[model samples]
Target: MNIQPLFDYIRNHVTLTSEEETFLASKVSYRKYLKGQFVVQQGDVCKYESFVISGCTKTYYVDTEGQEHIVMFSVEEWWTADLGSFITQTPADYNIQCIENTELIMISSDDIEELYIKIPKLERFFRRVIERALAASQKRIIRSFSMSAKDRFLYFREKYPQIEQRIPQYMIASYLGITKEFLSKIKSQIILEQ
Candidate 1:
């Protein structure tokens, strides 16, 4: 499979020589999962940091009451991994499931360490990626506390219009910390305003 997207993504952050790109590509393997398949399960150690070649996956945790709380979603050209579990080699707290049939290029933790040692620029690239993820997470936390449900829904719609089309409404509601019924009402209100 073509890895130009991945190379381009890294190039946006740090320049990579052709040999470095080839070496990076050699360390990763391709895998595919059907919709509803779990890439990483709760209580199982996550072995790979996956880059989405296509489709979508969600990271979530299930409570004792069977409620699923979505932590994040990774669409095409994005990356997904349980950072703590991946780094610590411990059981994952969340499950990563394919929401759509997905293709991924995955590098194991060991391979990643090797890459960092062999190509220092990759370390810098990943640091920027993690920083952006943290900032987005922080912004989401602030929004959940400060923004109204309608405002949050509106913001989500603006930010990820494609996600709304691809995923179920209930999943979107879960991400927004709202009930599906409430989400329906919000959609209706938006339609009425139009």
Candidate 2:
């Protein structure tokens, strides 16, 4: 499978010599998952951190009440993983499942460390990636407290643009921490306002 998109993405973050790129290429593998297949399951240790090559996946957690709460969605060019599990080598609390058939470039945690030594600049790139993820997460937490449900839905639309069309309304509602019916009502209200 072509991994040039990954190389392109990396290039945007840091300079990579051809040899570094070639070595990095040899370190990663590609996997394709059908819709409903899971890349990482709750209670299992997550071994690979994956980058989306195509399609989409949802990162969610199932509560004790058996309710699924969607945390985020990863589409083409996005990355998905249970960062806590991947970084700590512990069991993951979240499940990352394919929403559409998905192809991903995967690197094992061990390989990532090796890449750090061989390509020092790659560590800088990953630091930026993780920091941004953390920042977005912090922003989401703040928004949840500060924004109204309707406003949260609108902001979700603005931030993830067109994501509404790709996943079920219920999943969107879960991400927004609202009931699907409420989300429907919000949509209707927005339509009326427009």
Candidate 3:
């Protein structure tokens, strides 16, 4: 498989030398996950930061009622990790699971720190990534409080149109904090309007 897209993404974000690229690549390992498998589970320390190569994954939390609430979804080229737990070395409050059979490139937290030392630009790269993630999370929170369910659904479709075909309707409902029946109704309405 081509690592060029991933390399290009990093290069666009931060400058790196040939040696640094080789070093970083050496530090990363490829892994595959089957659907229904957990990459990192709740209460487990997140030891690695993973980049999706293919398929879909979701970060979610299980509530007391055993309901899963999706926090985010990662498709090809996206990164998925429990940032808080990874940095703090504490147990994760959420779980990252593969929504489909998936391939990922992962680097351990320690190795990532090593990467920063060897390739200083990577520190800048990750900082920007974190900034974007935080900003996106803030916007999502604002939208959750301000927008109607139908509006949120529409926005989700606009933002990640392929997600509709990849993720189950019930999971999408959970992600939007709506009931599956409500989502179905909204979908039907949207279809009729179209």
Candidate 3, residues 35-84, lDDT tens digits: the string is 98999999999999988888899999999999889999999888999999
By lDDT, who's the top model here?
2
TM-score of model 1 (CA atoms) = 0.97
TM-score of each: 0.97, 0.99, 0.96
Candidate 3 or 2, higher TM-score: 2
Order of quality (lDDT): 2, 1, 3
The candidate with the higher TM-score, 1 or 3, is 1
After superposition on all C-alphas, the RMSD of every candidate to the true structure, in Å, is 0.9, 0.6, 1.2
The backbone clash count of each candidate, in order, is 0, 0, 0
Runs with alpha carbons beyond 4 Å of true place in candidate 1: none
Q: For candidate 2, write residues 1-194 as lDDT tens digits.
A: 78998999988889999999999999999999999999999999999989999999999999999999999999988899999999999999999999999999999999999999989899999999999999999999999999999999999998788678899999999999999999999999999999
Off by over 4 Å in 3: none
RMSD of 3: 1.2
Pairs that collide in candidate 2 are: none
Model 1 deviation from native, Cα RMSD in Å: 0.9
